[model samples]
Target: MLSYGFWNNKGGTGKTSLCFQSICFYAHQHPEERILVIDVCPQANLSELLLGGLANGGSDRLLARQGAVPRATIGGYFQQRLPSPYQPPAIEPLDYITTPCEYNDEIPENVDLICGDPLLELQANAISTLANNNIPGTDSWIAIIDWIKDLLQPLSGKYDVAFIDCNPSFSIYTQIALSTVDRMVLPVMADDSSRRAIQNAFSLVYGLKLPSDIYATYAFATRLRNANRTLPKVHMIVKNRLTQYMGKASAYAAVLRSIDRDIEKLMDSNPEIFTFEALNDGIVDVRDFQTTGVVAFAKGTPLYSLKTGKRDVMGQRVTVHEDYKANCVEHMNDLVGQL
Candidate 1:
């Protein structure tokens, strides 16, 4: 399966929201292709939105999945791998998969999920320790980080594409998911910090422009290269939550241009780090979805499936204007088109 990882070094870029909406849109657009979503973030918000949103008992449904006999979640899969971190295990990947449509009818039938869990917060230390284990000629780090890739190997032909919603941090779980990624979707906001985040993400994932060579041996990119494994190329940089200030004269324009210039510089220096040869083809800007997004996210409904008018969301009334809803749908269509 071709895996697309959604991530950013900095938080508050609306990464998870963009990821959730993008996957739903992608699944709806490509109904013939069986889709899989892996929620690698410990918060599991994407899993909740996938199962059912705030208005539809999403939290309750997620808890039930976490409480399953074998526990059908990413944490569950990790637990199984704990005993055999360095060696391949016989556990079935499908055993850990859940059909989101089963809980939320609004989601497409072709989409499956490996739900995220709160247990991951507790599991991080153990996973980190395992990766750092000094075993003789074992390359324990690589073996530990490739857990997700190993899980997906069994279902090679079953899934056409996979979307992973990653944690903001460079957690071991995120590394596990990124290890399987063919392309990365990085979402950034319009600000100077986001500009720096672009550079930081490249440094973290591809070992580009580090302060010194002293840290090169400890970088994720270095380890991947040493293992003879290719790192994922940045496929799309989604400029998310954009406003009208994106125009040339807008005050935010300078920052936006600076962001573009940074990418342009990266393109000139390390063209191998990206999939697209041109910056325009690789970057996308998404407008703020406004109230339309509020209602859709609250109900865990894809923007395309949402209707205009007021809807009760957990006792609060949300009004989704027709124009706003249409705009959001169009934005989603444009965003997913790049995928």
Candidate 2:
């Protein structure tokens, strides 16, 4: 399966929102293809949003409440096997897979979820310990990293695409998630904090010790100037939560220019590591659909599926404007096209 991770060290960048929209659009575009969404965030916001709500509990609660046979979460897999580092057990992706649509017709059937759990926070430390451990005649840190990768190996031919929504931090879980993905989708806002978040993400990738085999391939690449190696190709740098209004056109343009300059400076500083050009056409700007997004999330429906009508919002009846719905669809299509 082709895996893509939507990540940013900084939160509130609409990372999860973009991931949700992208996967939904992908599934809608290719109904025959199986798509898996693994939520590796401790907050489980993506899990809750995609699965409808926390009340519509899935494998995470199934495993926790009933003490199910096989642990049914990404964190649970590591929590169960990290203790036996010398001989880690195998984990099947299907065992943890939860068909949210099967339970609720409102959801897309082609999309499956590996629900996230708050327990992942606890497992993060254990995974780090195992990764740093140097036990004689035992498994190496690379083995531990591979163990996490193995969890998703069974999904190779089963799904067409896998979208991973990671935590907004550089933890062992994030590292494992990053290692497995073929492409990284960075969602950043047009602001200073977002710029710093991008820098931090690049720094994190530079510091990480990827598999020796992978590292060997980039050893001779001239683009990577420093001792720190590069990372997987950044598929796109998305500018999320953009506000497009004629009233503030100049102001917004200035912000975009600022963001552009920040990206240029970043590439200049780390030429070898960030050789991927940040072209004007390459960076997608997803306009802010404030209330539209809220309605979509609340209804657990794709923005494209939303119709022009009145909908109840927290006991308040509100009209869903046709123009707003069209804008959302336009943006979604644009994002999918860019991808």
Best by lDDT: 1
lDDT by residue for model 2 over 143-191, one digit each (tens)?
A: 6655556776666688888899988997778876776676788888877
Clashing pairs in 1: none
TM-score of each: 0.98, 0.84
Which runs of model 1 end up more than 4 angstroms from their true locations? none
Determine the backbone clash count of candidate 2.
Answer: 1
Question: Against the true structure, whose TM-score is highest?
Answer: 1
- Residue 187, candidate 2: C-alpha displacement in angstroms: 1.0
Put down candidate 1 lDDT per residue, 27-128, tens digits, no spaces. Answer: 988999999999998899999999889888888999999999688999999999999999988998878899999999999999999999988989999999
